[model samples]
Every structure is written in C-alpha cells, then in structure tokens.
Target: MGNYKWHPRFLNPPRYRKENSQLNIHLWNIMKARVSTNVEKVYERLRVIVS
Candidate 1:
C-alpha cells in the first residue's frame, strides 16, 4: 500500500468561493442519476437544491 498525506486546503476549503464545491455537486448529480429509481424525481430535487 502507498502512504498518503492530506493537504491543508483539502481539510479547510476557502469560504465564499466554489472551486472544489462544483466538482462535488457534479459528482452528486451523477451518483443520483445512477441509483435513482425515478430519474426525473432526482432531477427535480437537484433543481430545487441548486436553484
């Protein structure tokens, strides 16, 4: 196994700016789409959250 170290920025992201956040949101949407029983329902929920 390889040793891994966490970066300081990863522990504490800067506030009021969305750099890494957007990636997280994108991943969340993808995951929801994959597992969702109703794709439209998931999309509606995401729209409510994002909007």
Candidate 2:
C-alpha cells in the first residue's frame, strides 16, 4: 500500500462555484428524502410488532 499526500490541486475551489453549489444542494435534498423514508418504514414495522 502506498501512502498518498494531500494534493494542492484538490484543495482549490471549483471554477463554477454557483452551479456546483446548486447541484450539491439538490443532491443533499435527495439524500435526506431517502434517509427519512427508510426511517419511517422501520418505525412502522416496530409499531406493528408492538401492537
């Protein structure tokens, strides 16, 4: 296994900051929705078992 050093190029901000930020926000919302739905399904299953 080779040890990799942090590269300076990776630290630079994206040239298209506005568009990148918008895309990031959209992806974040999708992730949040998926997580919430999974949680709801688990809760419902537990509720049924309890009842």
Which window of 10 residues has the lowest lDDT sum in candidate 1? 1-10
* C-alpha TM-scores of all predictions: 0.38, 0.67
List candidate 1 stretches off by more than 4 Å.
Answer: 1-17, 37-51
After superposition, candidate 2 runs with Cα above 4 Å error: 1-16
Q: What lDDT does model 1 reach?
A: 0.67
Model 2 lDDT per residue over 1-51, tens place: 233323543333446577776876687699899999999999999999999
Residue 7 of model 2 has an lDDT of 50
The sequence of per-residue lDDT tens digits that candidate 1 reaches over residues 1-51 is 233224555435566358567875677688777777587778999999999
Question: Cα RMSD (Å) between model 1 and the true structure?
Answer: 10.8
